[model samples]
Target: MTKPQKAIIIGAGPAGLAAALRLQQYNHISSVVYEIRPKPTTLGGAIGIPSNGLRLLHRLGLYDNIRLRAAETSNLVLHAIKGDVIGKADLTSWSRDKTGFGYLRIQRTSLMDVFYDAARLADIPIHFGKRLVGIVENSDGVTATFDDNTSDTADFLLGCDGIHSAVRKLYVDPNMTPEYSGVVNIFSLLETIMLPQARLSLDGLNATLTTDGLLALCPCTATNEMIYWFFSRQLSMPPGGGGRDGWEEKGKQEVENLKVTLLELLKDTSGEWGDMWKAIINQTNVVKFYPIFRMVLGGQWARGRCLILGDAAHAMQPHASQGVSMALEDVFLLSKLLEIPGRSLEEVYAVYEQKRRPRTDRMSKMAERNGNVRKKTGPWQLWLQECAISGMMSVYNLCRLDRLGIGQKELAYDVEEEEV
Candidate 1:
């Protein structure tokens, strides 16, 4: 009998967890996941899990449990800067279709908890506080050293450790670094209030382009108690002034400083819309700023037996909102590719990149274009673009590009690498 393969995944976030869950299905393989954050704490903001993300979760046996904890939105609303409704995207019919199961707007922590629980149920071991600091790879396997002075070796290593991935550092050209776009994205959470007019004006999960920046608000969870807000503008000060650039440990003072510009841009809004901002600023204890940056796909995703996925491989603007979904897609696709035989790990890794890179690259460019459109300042240009988007969305709720594979056949990722 062939010996069981062993794998180690760094980072227990959604991407890492999904990979773990898929690997768990192969009884012969022993897989372990390492996370930096311990239990009882979670990562940032409201994540809109479109039908694709939900589908992956469902396939992994986590759909029902997660759905029970999240809020489902039937429609997407578009608004003007002054709190006026420009368009309403009805998703009721789409939500009911086989492909369009709508979207679940859930707290990031809640989603992580569910994934963690599901992984536990599957007997997958996830070690917390194991921050990956270094990676060593050879033709035969890979070894990861964590901050806790622990190390593990596996037949293969998947670096789902996020943007500042240690694995990527080893292979990517040092000159082609991730450049910041000079925009600081401030994400805030607020107590959900029932103000149909305000909600419609801001466009719940439907992005809205305004004069100053892009403001997006979406429902989170089922209780109507929490909502997610994102506000962005060109940064006059450096990212997290006088502090490190990482968003994970940003200070409240910096967030407060950014809120000043946000408040000015939102000055015209009134009634419940204004109140929502006030509540968000006053009540929220947690906030984060992502200095938008884009990474060019330079290095091959895998070096020897070490591989990278998700933002670690392709960090792009969030305008596409596919960061998580794309990562989810990676888990399934990579799992299939790893199941393949005859070919070497490098060959399988190359195939995985060939099949996935084009799609992600296209989406990254689209997101950059979307950001440009949102940042358009000239009156005529902004109006024409918004009207065009509104018109397009009016007829078809799903973006044309998204519809092609929306909940359809899972991208036929290769399987010989993992097949027994």
Candidate 2:
């Protein structure tokens, strides 16, 4: 097999940045990250990097760098919207023992800054405002045509371009897309006085579910007085279906139509949760509505000399908060496989898809199922959750599902083995 000299990474988000950094370190792989979003530094949202993710950050020498900029969350508290203490679990103890670290709650922009700075330190060039227009791959390599009509070629092209990936469309089939889970994630961050009723420690996070839907309140690691809430409800799927491919083309009016519809669903919770809902809604901050959808992959994640990573391959619901973590996992696994001794690109890609696809697929299914159990109107389900909560001391413990593969042997590049 030929040595990996150059590669092209689409999207400068966490996954792409991690891949570029690791590949550069091990394979001395020169790369360029093409991102359509300009001013990537300004992108902001609350993102929780679990202990598993923290371990990877440590490997890249950015763990402490991120720790200084982010808040460490001990648990995810679960409560009844009606003000009843339901289930709680101590996530810090469970995961800390397993991975030697805890969860870090940081803004999306903050996390990106850490990754981007590390890439810069490693001298990885990131090309912003470059939209991919076309992709042509042959037996030897792949070429990417950008919206500016400029083109670049490399040994392989990695598509980390999120759910709506042009590279996926060009190399893979056009029909495979992320479908709506009948949910709209309405989230906002705002300054608020630390009220006594707020169950989350000014330092912790909460996942409160009612007969209405799910409301998650978590403190911002960057700001103590501010809190982030992700409010969502299940919606009925439209006829003929809605998905990532057809989502943007659905038009503002159609999307707006759905937003108004989701707003109406929140009506049931309006008169129930004190003025908490009012305070959140009336705050002088920006609120954004995102359509929640899960991607169902068709065929495989790689084709010929092209491969897709992150949301491009498997866009899962955010229930388990594993979206970015799984993407990080891809960085670890794929990069290690590529560094293998005498392995062809095709063989490495095949191994990566085989190892990762099942895990991500299982996680996606869990998110969908959990969404159903979290619906507020379900009496039996709520009762079951409440019973489980009582058996635990913290909200984190109550909501702890089967601890998945955390101690899986870390996949690292073995230079001695590869060289021999």
Candidate 3:
């Protein structure tokens, strides 16, 4: 019998937990997880899980659970800044038959709960509050040291840490860092009764292109009594603003300032439609603020037996909503490569990069375009955007003509099927 393989994983977020779950399936693969955070957080807003990610989650026995806690949207309806409907992208029926799953929108915390539960059931050890500060690799394998003064040696290490990955900086490339996306995304939760217009607009994912930024709203809970919404806009980094460069969450005073800034921008909006959106911000109790960031797309993912995945490997602009999905895909693909025989750890790492980089590069570019489009638009630019969207969605609703893969291509990202 072959000896067991030992693996060390950093960051107990979605990527690390998913890696632990997949590796537990093979008795020969023994893995351990370490997280930087003190404990599990129910923070963050809703995330959209695409079909490619859904497929892997299903195989990991997570899809059914995710569906139970998730809300399904039929389509993403687009509206102009002035509250006129422009287009709709089919979300439910178009690709269900082909992919065996539709898009899922769920809170990030809910999904993390599921992953943590599965890891516990599998008896996988996850040490929280253990931050990775250093990594050392040799021909024998890799040794990872945590802030707690604990160290572990494994056949190889997988850096599932987030965008500010310690493993990547200490091992892969110390010079590489995540660049601020210049957009701060603010999300809030509100009762369905807070805005009647939003309740009526909650038929699906409602995305509006405004002069200030892009605002998106969706019903996340099953009862449809609560709505999750977010808005993205640019912010300038003040010189010597004392940690205003977008790292830590702001204090109570700063939060109030954010609300004031937002209200000032939307103060001009006047009407029932405007009130609905403004009320969403004014009446909310909890607001999540995030300064988006992205990494250089084309870079080395592996060096010797150490490699990175998830946000550590590629941090695309959140405009595409594929950051988590890409990480989910990476862990599953790595597990599949582990099944291949006669391949050294380094060899598998190379194949992992070979299989994944092309897709990440494409997403990186698409996210850039999408992010630019969502930025503050001029009069002519907003008009052109609305017209283009109206035309494409009109055609898709009429003839199901999705040359840009609106409903078809996105919901069916089966790389193996494509190869066949």
Say which candidate scores most in TM-score: 3
TM-score, candidate 2, is 0.83
User: How displaced is residue 35 in candidate 2, in Å?
Assistant: 1.0
Per-candidate TM vs. native? 0.82, 0.83, 0.90
Model 1 spans > 4 angstroms off: 1-4, 26-28, 38-41, 91-100, 137-140, 147-149, 171-176, 193-203, 236-254, 257-260, 270-286, 376-388, 391-420
lDDT per residue for candidate 3 within 262-332, as digits (tens), equals 56655555555567777787688788777777898677789887889899989888887777778877887
Taking all chains together, the TM-score of candidate 1 against the true structure is 0.82
Q: How big is the positional error of residue 319 in model 3, measured in Å on the Cα after superposition?
A: 1.2
Please give the CA lDDT of all the candidate structures: 0.69, 0.70, 0.77
- For candidate 2, write residues 115-188 as lDDT tens digits: 98898888898989998988887877889999898889999889988887887887765668767677767677
> Comparing 1 and 2 by TM-score, which wins?
2
Model 1 Cα lDDT, one tens digit per residue, 178-240:
666556677877766633445534434644566767777777877556778887655554455
Worst 10 residues of 1 by lDDT: 407-416
Better of 2 and 3 by TM-score: 3
